[model samples]
Target: MTTRTSRRAGGRQARQALRAAPLAKETRPVRAGLEGGAYKPLTQAGMERIHQAALDALEQIGLADAPQSGIEIMTRAGAILGDDGRLRFPRALVEDMLAKAAKNITLHGRDPQHDMNLSGTRVHYGTAGAAVHMVDVDGREYRDSTVQDLHDAARIADQLDNIHFLQRPMVCRDIPDNRDMDLNSIYACVAGTTKHIGTSFTEPDFVDDGIELLHMMAGGEDKWRARPFVSNSNCFVVPPMKFATESCEVMEKVIAAGMPVLLLSAGMSTATAPPTLAGTIVQAVAECLAGVVYVNAIKPGHPAIFGTWPFVVDLRSGAMSGGSGEQALLAAGCSQMHQFYGLPGGAASGFSDAKLPDMQAGWEQMCSNVMAGLSGLNMVYEAAGMHASLLGFCHESLILGDDIIGQALRCVRGIEVTEDAVDLDLMRSVCLGGPGHYLGEDQTLSLMQTEYVYPTLGDRTSPKEWAEVGKPDLVQAAKTRKETILAETSRAHLDPIVDQAIRARFNIHLPR
Candidate 1:
């Protein structure tokens, strides 16, 4: 009887020790900058064929609607501006600019700890989208997003371990002035998080105004240029081989100011672009290549993100299917092409077709996210909290997406086949010795936080435990997490003096 009692007491001690095991963030299993590229959806020959096709499209079909400045830049860089107004790029010029394109780039965060190195298949996932409406998880309704909503989203993203950076995810509809909207968007994101930010300018002049504020935040023009935190997510092309004149002007200004530019070419297949997936990839690459020529012409070697974001269309409805399998394929395939060029690139993923955060959203969000990460995408944009085909942003969904991305990043990290991992001493000990289980074993305790991942808001309880805990709703849990984060979150990633000065000069919307 004493022997049995001693065994039971030992079991209690083991359970208490397991419960006390540390799971510190610094020792977590997965993290940003994990090398992905394990999943290659396209063959070398296929990538080459696509590349040649893109080059052929650029050389033969060319692009239309170049601003006079674009024409001047391209013409000086071996491009032919025909009488028909199509600015045609020579194969030589495209190839030359490709060589000049910045391959390895560092995306700076105001807090240096969060900086990401963009090269090879090093993958990082973050938020992006111009979602106009905020998904109200509680009310199950949508509302026009305000600047406060954008600021809160950034605050929540700041705390999410998996969300590596911040991009303008929603529009601040309340700010009517285009200039204020541009500057305030930067202020809101900067104030909310020190993570690398991506934002846009509606006008060229707005880019100047926004940069002035960014310079202030960075302490001066030189410091801001040395490590610009915000990259311009400029949609420089209007698909179908047409340059958006105003957007191209903004890109030029963004480049001149030393801000990284995402050469975004958003074309929807079966509508603006060709129907076939290959054709869509071809067009998107061709457009981004043209952007490269334009940028290199202005400056010999400038930082630019090869953003070939093409959305798949639901033919039956003639609407963009951002969460469709086809969209996933397009993003993954484009990532392969980025590797082909040996340049830093971005493509869209982590979007859901569902209007709400349901099972449908779960499947849709994970599908593209895993595929994009495994394909070795350098920057996975719009990888969280976007819904309704990119028209709505949900804060609760964003909170839950942190959990999803954690799992996805784990997939990117894959299995580390170290000799220690393969050693079976622990296995033999567990099978042969004391408790006949590995629970609380030395190796198990040691590897707990390093070899495994735990979700922040996701529940993994058994049915009995779930019931014991009141069977908490996952969505409600996410909402509660959101509230908790916002209540304790800081928008003071920026220095108080700098933030105060920004608010003093600009129409800063978010309150203290």
Candidate 2:
């Protein structure tokens, strides 16, 4: 017989269970930390303006070379399509889709054993896609990355608790062929570890191969569909507005096959789109929406994440500056747009053009990541250890980034409400000098673990104690932590037969 548990009863039972267990007091209560910094929450008025502007661009300027089928769909749905291929969407349709899209999605990581809950108050951290640096075990730097470098990067990501997902190819690893190499790298990482993976396959065959591997790993097509055993395909929409044929194909295959897709359109202000930040964001949004519509059209109710990496062009030189204020604003705006569409948003943050891990890197990473988190983005790419303008990755940066993400996450945690948290009776008792000392209180001991987050890197000791231990900086502590975690942690195990099948398909030898 099935038993029913009321919500209140369930909570009461959990609290009672906790109270019955022996309490061990070790860590201090976690401090209330900062929320996302410098990000102005988008107002309803501002969002309305953006929506109108996007419609104007679609109707007046019109998008170029969007698939005719997409245009036909929009046109039939009351969008005005110009003879020249520009189409204007009614504000109502845009709002309708926004309301219908799914805002919350759970990304299942490599360890089927572990999953990150993304909706509501929970925040997850992970690195951005496409880092080009190579760092050895001893923290020495190499100029570029190889296939082995990708493997090592996967291993590092697998060990990091803060990192909840993997974006494929950690670097452009070489195999005899790029297509075969793409599939091999994805298989190696997915099989070697258990983390949700994000991959963008340029070729159709590779997409099929990746999907096949996911089905095998997930046990079957049905199970794979339920929890997304494979990676989400990230497609770049041609911006200041359009979707390329290949990207369209990739999106179609991924969405139709029941895999999640992240549609990203990055536009450089004054270069790709208009010089104005607002204009660029509108254009970027339209471009991303166009891609989203395509996916939705192929398979209605397909899971898709709408996103952008819009940044300002260094007007003086035409380079993309990772640290631009415009980028932070775009991240925030994109989050709002995703909310508008009722879909989760992804954006690049925690990255800088700085050559090393220094003040510039810290500030740039902090500002962008905090903005993304505060705006309530679903998945943030480039959350850790990117430098040299996102073309490089450093082991030290990864260590440092863990702390930064921790701080950002702490900000989004909002506030918790419970009877014990309110503690009105306890407060009244203290007011009467009835065991006013919190140090000896049963409540303090009971709630500490639930309320606190112990840091692996930040220094919390006294100056004398810190000096006595070793006056190591945050980076040093992080390095030590990285080593310890890597050493003790085991790679997620895979079935021997499945591993063999993957190896035989790819013609690569599995490590004994």
Best by lDDT: 1
What candidate 1 gets wrong by more than 4 Å, as runs, is 1-26, 489-493
Per-residue lDDT of candidate 1, residues 9-115 (tens digit): 77668656755785565677878888999888889999999999999998899999999998998898899988889998889999999998889999999888899
Clashes of 1: 0
List model 2 lDDT by residue over 275-330, tens digit each. 87778778887777665555554555566767676777787788778776668777
lDDT against the true structure, each candidate: 0.89, 0.66
Q: What is candidate 2's TM-score against the reference?
A: 0.82
- Per-prediction CA RMSD (Å): 2.1, 7.8
Top model by TM-score, which number?
Answer: 1
Candidate 1 clash pair list = none
Q: What are the TM-scores, per candidate, against the unseen true structure? A: 0.96, 0.82
